[model samples]
Target: MLQETSRDPVGVLVVEDDAVTRKALCLAIESDPGLKLLDAFDSVKPALDFLESSSPDVLMTDLGLPDGSGIDIIHACARRHPATDIMVVTMSSDEANVLACIEAGASGYVLKDAGKLDIARAVLDLRAGGAPMSPAIARMVLAKVRDNKKPAVPQSSPASDTTSLTRREAAILDLIAQGESYGEVAKMLSVSVGTVQTHIKNIYGKLSVHSRGEAVYEAHRRGLLQLGRPPGKRS
Candidate 1:
């Protein structure tokens, strides 16, 4: 029988292609009394299939899978299980990877080099609604923020024509850029998914953009979206 603990265990699904690493992660999660390992998968396909029928409270996934990228897993989970927290547990600490994962609605980012205890602590923090990042990852995020360039405005720029977004609208757009589905944004904002959809439509109309990618790109161009801060942090 699977070892069960008395405390309310946060069910977790582990997704990593490496057999040894996957087993080790599963062991670490099992050792923690606050986490319960619901399932482990070596590829995205099966993991997504399992998520459709069953739900886990947290998802710990690797960035590079043999079949698909971890971003795919994050996108799927955000749609299927909006309330499930996501953590990226991978070897790549590249700034691009970090930004991509966070944009994809991940609540935590931990490198594989993080010790078992660190991973456990990250999971716990994620469950508690805090964005967890390994020390190096956190530093990388800060560096990106520091290096960001301010958008330039022409000297004759008209204030009336300048695109202005409300705090909530900007927050919703940030999440949308980060790859969160409508359902996930709704849960995070405590609003109906229909409300999220309506906001997204209005955002597109204001920006003259048609798709999510376009909206994110436009927001970045306008300096409306910034790195380091989690989506919805402003409101």
Candidate 2:
């Protein structure tokens, strides 16, 4: 496992094909004092090359590129830098594209139409161990999950709900399912970021999930969470 990157001002790598959109996205990330623009590229190969040398704390990429699909870059980042938080900023929301990115380790998916502020905020939330997804993207994922559902779950052994999560862990899991970042959750609960992170780990342990997405999905599968975001979490 890779050691965590120091993310005082979260380091961001952006890959977009369009010159205009690329410039705008980079500028928006730069506009946020809490984020730093590590590098920006308009192609998959160069972005892949950059990842070979330095792993940014966050990667924001468009799905289409001249050389190849952004999904390629996402898979590369997920392999080389598992600690990196990936957000897909794409114009395409096709079911295959959305599912592919998430499977490739993307935790956030925002449409290209989102404003610059939304773009930047998504990076912040992603780096803070949150799954910041567009509402449509969230719906798409949930729809797929529902479609895959069997009429009846195995009455046999599923992960035991009786395992029990602490009240604090339950609260943190709920906020996380609601797409709240650690900083946001800390603020909401009047706790330190460290405190929230600790609870997050405990939640993962109790839920037997290795990632935030898995924790959310497992909780939802167990009826502890309903997999949907409220309004205003576009970032």
- Candidate achieving the largest lDDT: 2
lDDT of each: 0.75, 0.77
Question: Which regions of candidate 1 fall more than 4 Å away from where they truly are?
Answer: 1-7, 114-117, 149-235
lDDT string for model 1 (1-235, tens) is 1122126888999999999989988988899988899999999999989988988888999989999899898888866776677888899998888887766667678887766546677787666535677889878765665566565442444432587777788988877655465666778888876677678778767766534544665677677775456655766
Give a tens-digit lDDT track for model 2, residues 16-76.
9899999998989899998999999999999999999998988999988999999999889
How do the predictions measure up, each by TM-score? 0.63, 0.71
Clashing residue pairs for model 2 = none
Q: Pairs clashing in candidate 1?
A: 103-178
Reference-based lDDT, residue 27, model 1: 88
